[model samples]
Target: MKCIIGLGNPGKKYDRTRHNVGFMVIDELIQRHQWKLDKSKFKADYTIVQTENEKLMLVKPQTFMNLSGDAVRPLMDYYHIHLENILIIFDDLDLPIGKIRLRQKGGHGGHNGIRSIIEHVGSKDFKRVRIGIGRPDSSLSIIDYVLQTFPKRDTEEVMNSVNKAADACEAWVHKPFPEVMNEYNQ
Candidate 1:
């Protein structure tokens, strides 16, 4: 089995914020598959779908961003899914908007959500899909920038990245991570 885990804060308040791009990708994938993350357990909303020869699980943890591992670790354990079989998607501060990057393994790069997952999962060796949100402007605090929704000027770019991120996820479901990374991490 494979798992696609999107890291984001839970609630309507954070819905369209830069920090919730991960959730947006999950939503896009869910919509494409005509599925819903209706099951709530391990502090996550998830759904499982079986394809011709494999199964895939779409998950959005409800433990919020910083405590994401509180849900991810248990869910992986319960499902007997290997760390290599999972891909984590989250926002990145280093890349410009409209870009998506994929990595087979890496550090959290100061993201609390990735930090928590690395701590709980006990390794930096895992798949990741990062949606670039860029750094905050000089006037805005980092936290404030991430919590705020995209302005009108950025809406088109953000939506494009979200769509590509979702496509990358579906690619992972069908092929290996390296090939999917090469295809999407342009």
Candidate 2:
């Protein structure tokens, strides 16, 4: 089965923060499917979806960002999901805001969440969708920047990126991931 893991800190405080773009995309997809994250285990909130052609899981790890592997590894083991069938969605500080990049495999690039997943999963070979949160200004600390809500000027763009990411994920349910990447990564 396929799995889509969204990395973010759970709860009200983290909602809408730049670092929570992954959650935003997952929320969009859940809404589009009218599905609820009705199960909680492996330090995560998740739901399973089964259709004529696909079966997959939507997951949001509740172990917070730094310890994400605590949640991911367990869920994968329980579900017997292959690394190739898993897609991780998280924020990227390198790309400009409102942009996204998809890759079949990559290093963590200093993201604690992705680092944790790589450590727990014992592989750097999984699909990823990185939504750009952008680097902060020199005056702002990375922690402060990532935890803050999107500025008014950036709200529209950020939401657009979230929607686009969600659309790409939905397309993955039917089309191959490479095709989805080609369509959305341009």
Residues 1-186 of candidate 1 have per-residue lDDT tens digits of 999999899999999999999999999998887998989999999999997668999999999799999999999999999999999999999999999999999998999999999999999999999999999878999999999999889999999999999988888888888899889877
Q: After superposition, which runs of candidate 2 have C-alpha atoms over 4 Å from their true positions?
A: none
Compose the digit string of candidate 2's lDDT tens values, residues 1-186: 789988899999999998899888889989988999999998999999895688989999998899999999999899899898899999999989999989989999999999999999999999999999999878999999999999999999998999988888888889888899999999
Against the true structure, candidate 1 reaches a TM-score of 0.98
Check candidate 1 and list the clashing pairs: none
lDDT of 1 at 135: 91
List TM-scores for all candidates, in order. Answer: 0.98, 0.98
- Locate the minimum summed-lDDT window of 10 residues in model 2: 164-173
Model 2 whole-model lDDT (C-alpha atoms): 0.92
User: Which window of 10 residues has the lowest lDDT sum in candidate 1?
Assistant: 49-58
Give me the overall lDDT of model 1: 0.92
Query: Going through the candidates in order, what is the number of backbone clashes in each?
Result: 0, 0
